[model samples]
Target: MSLRVQQMLGYTLLSAAFFIGFFHRFAPATFAEPIARTFDVGSTALGGLASMQFWVYTLMQIPAGVIVDRYGIRVPASVGTALVGIGAAVLALAPSFALAMCGPALVGFGMSIVFVSVMKNNAIWFTGQRFGFITGCTLLTAAMGSIASEAPAALLLRISAWQPIFLALSVLSLILAALLASFWRPPPAEDCGQLTARNKKERTKIFGTIRSVIARPQIWLIMLAISGTNGTFYAFAGLWGTPLLVHSFGFERDTAALAMTLSLVPYGLGSLFLGQISDKLRTRKAFIIAASGASTVAWVWLVSAGSATPVVAWICFVLLGLSSSQVVASFAAVKESVPDEATGTALSLVNMGVFLTTAIVQFGYGWLVASAGTGSTITGDLYRIALWLPAAISIAGLLGALKVSETFPREQHQNQPANTQMAIRGQLQPPYRDGD
Candidate 1:
């Protein structure tokens, strides 16, 4: 195959891997109540089990990146996929709550590696200008997976128990793992090559690289935005959005699911569209600021307006989906800011920020809802609370965007290595200048 074909195929397979992995993490979302009832536990206990998965994923992101940096993408991606399969199998067979929780935690561990590996590989294969678009496309698949967890997931639960759903997912993960093993090869060993060190000296340098990324003040701000925005959305979308619709609007479960699905369908589309816009404009920061600002305003209106405006709520949620592309900006920023050699590590740092915040947000939202007492039916209030949390967090990201100067430092700074510039701009030489 031609190189372009190879890259496209690679992107396709990786996108598939991401889609399956994300679906596995999120597909069980609507089944929270079913799992709780099966285990005879309170909502808090059930949520805590799910939260454990996020916590592990969050904590492992940086290390997962390090593994990718030291080794290559194959081992981490392949092994992680196997782990997800194993976790799924375990969850499917679990006869107890404790055993069930183990499944998700294992899945989380495996998933952590998969996410970072895919992103790291993308950095090597794709251009900086395309990062936002590719990130959006990849995430669009992820969002589709989440949507599967939402509406179709609800339907699947009615067809069979959660066991079957997870078992099928496990099989899918294994298949994808095998496909990746067969097809996915890292770039030639000489392209900035994999970070290799013979002994302690190299390890220390790696450690130092990580420390440098961590010490940057703006990384924390970016992290805050990524985590807060993603966490709040995941918290509400995965666990609470449907419930909110049902209780607040007096809709049936299916109707609620439909509403949530409609709201989310636009998420991927918006990301795809806006990602292109960001690339064309050559300014991801402005896009991030605009998206976040819109989300904040839209969500505030959601909380204050209430049932008097269902259409308005729909509009606001769709707007939220569009704005959620701030993540693409974060991804672009991290890739652009760091040394090419540290791409994986830098991204891992950002992932740690995003997932950790997501865990906290989801857990906090769950705690708040649980505290409202059982079966009181306060979905509207729950959503409103969750919306406000993200809105506030997104503002931080918007502010952080103002501080970031480049989306692709080498290109923007006119300092790209010849090979990299050729690969990125699809030409062997920079645009000519008269003097040079």
Candidate 2:
């Protein structure tokens, strides 16, 4: 195949890997009842089972970034895809819930690197202008996976059991992994992030690189902002959104699934829409600020609108989805702030917040709901209490957007140093132009 064709195929295969991970990430939401039944567990136990993915995923973030940086994307991405397939298969065939929890944990370990790898590859393969747009497009694609996990997945459960569905997903993941392994060969060793240092030296280099990234004050802000805004949204969308609908508005499982799916539609569109708009306008803070503020408003409205009507809830979900799109801005913002060499590390740092928060809140929120002592028939008051959390956290996004330095750094060809691209274990590159 031609180079362009190869790139396209590589991108597509990676996208498939991402889709599987995304689907599996949220699969537990719809599978809650069946999995609980099969495993003989209640809400607290079930939350632990489901949040296992995020916990392992959170633990793997820095390591994933380091590995991708030291080894590059192709092999890690392939391994990740295979691991997801293996995890899915484990989940499909497992006889017990405790055993099944191992599946998502393994899957999380595998998929932890995917988002960083994709971002790293994009930095190498595409221009800065195209990066934001492509990132949005990828999220749009993953949102499809999210939708599949909800409505279509709920539809599939009607025909066959959840075990069969995940079994099929396992086969699909392996197929994609094989394709990624065979078809994708990146450029020479020099252009990629994979390092060549000896064991002791490489270890020193790895820690140093991460240290530099952590040393930056703004990374924490970006992490907090994203954790609060987009990160919080992800927390809800992955686990709580469907149940909230079911309990609060008296929707059935299928109807709640559909509503959750509809809620995700705007997030996909928002990612694509905000990415293009931010790229075109050459601005990040404004879009992020607007998105964060708007998402908070929309989510709070959702709390009150619980009694208004389902249509109002749907509209709020859509609005929240659109606002959540500003998350791409955080990725873009962090990427621009740091040097190219640390791109994977920086992006992973922020990405870590999303899943870490999800894991923490997911496990915690389950009990929070259970503690209301309502037992299954959870009230609107409980729903409001649960749903209000993400809204409060999202304020961090607005604050981080303001505090982080503006690096109109998308025009990567401009002030970026050639030596910096060629340098590793070196001081960070200057991202700004010669100005005030």
Candidate 3:
């Protein structure tokens, strides 16, 4: 096959894996009632079950990044995809709650590697200018999976039990894993020769590279910004949004899911366009700051609009998803903030912030809701109190956006042939110069 064909096939398969990861990520929210009924668990336990995935995913980010940096995408991506399949099958057959918990944890561990692999592949197969757009497309694809897990999955639940659905997911994931292993090819050596060489040379100093990535203030700021915006979105749309709507606003389950779908649809669409716009504008920080500000405003509106009408709630959800969609820009910013060789590490670090905050918010929200009461006893006022957590985090994200350095224009200007040669030889510092 031609290189272009190979790139297309490889990226497609990787995206398929990413899609499955996203489906599982949000599936619990759609099936929260059924899962709770099956296990006779309360809000806190369900939250813990869902948060299990984020916790494991959070812990695995650095290791996943290191493995991707060292071995490239093929072996790790294939194995990780298979693990997700196994986890789903485990969830399908689990005889008890504890065993079922293991399923999400395994899925989390498996999924932790997929995003870094996709981002690393994008860096290798595409040029720098298109990176933001490609990342946006990747997220757009992920949003489809999120959508599938929500409204469609809820509609399916009317006719079938959740177990059979997960079994089908398990089979699909396994097949995708097999295809990824068989057909996913790397970019041509000429395209990635320097990156491969750098990986080899840095293998012995992996810890040093990680430390350097961690030491960068820009990376930390990007992490805070993303954690606040995307983290809040995930905690809600991925798990709590539907429940809040159904229990608090008196919407039916399917209608609540449809509302979540509305949020995700815009989120996906916004990711696609906002990424392209960020690239065209040749700016990252501006979009990040704007997104953070918007997210903060949406949270405030949602919290203050007590017992909001369905239409008002829908507007807030849409705003939340759209504002958070600028997360694609944040990932691009992280990639641009570090050296090309350390891209995976930097991306992983920022990604860790997202899941870490997500896990906390998911668990914390559950704890807050559970503390107030249980099933049907939980009130809109209680949900409102829990929401302030994410709202405060969004404010922190806005602050981080303000502090993060502008990277796109500076990196574009510095990545000339001579600068590339210098970068390859480790003669230049990272492109994060102040006042760029």
Output the number of the lDDT-best candidate. Answer: 3
Candidate 2 residue-pair clash tally? 1
**What is candidate 3's TM-score against the reference?**
0.94
* Worst window of 10 by summed lDDT in candidate 1: 427-436
Per-residue alpha-carbon lDDT of candidate 1 for residues 1-436, written as tens digits (9 for 90 to 100)? 6666667777777777777777766654677878788888986787788777788998898888888777777777888888888898997888998888898899989988889888987787766678778887888888888778878888878889887888988898888788778777755444423322221234446787687678755456566656545656665566666666665556677776677777677777776776677777776667656666776676577667666556666676677666676777778767765566667788888888777767777776656665664576555666565555656666676566556544443446457566765543322323432111
Residues 53-116, candidate 2, lDDT per residue (tens digit)? 8999998999999988878788998898899999999988998877888899989998988877
Q: After superposition, how far is residue 398 of candidate 1 from its true place, in Å?
A: 3.4
Error of 1 at 227 (Å): 2.9
Give per-residue lDDT, candidate 2, residue 76. 93
Pairs in steric clash, model 3: none
- The numbered model that scores best in TM-score is 3
Tell me how candidate 1 scores on lDDT: 0.71
For each candidate, the alpha-carbon lDDT, in order, equals 0.71, 0.77, 0.86
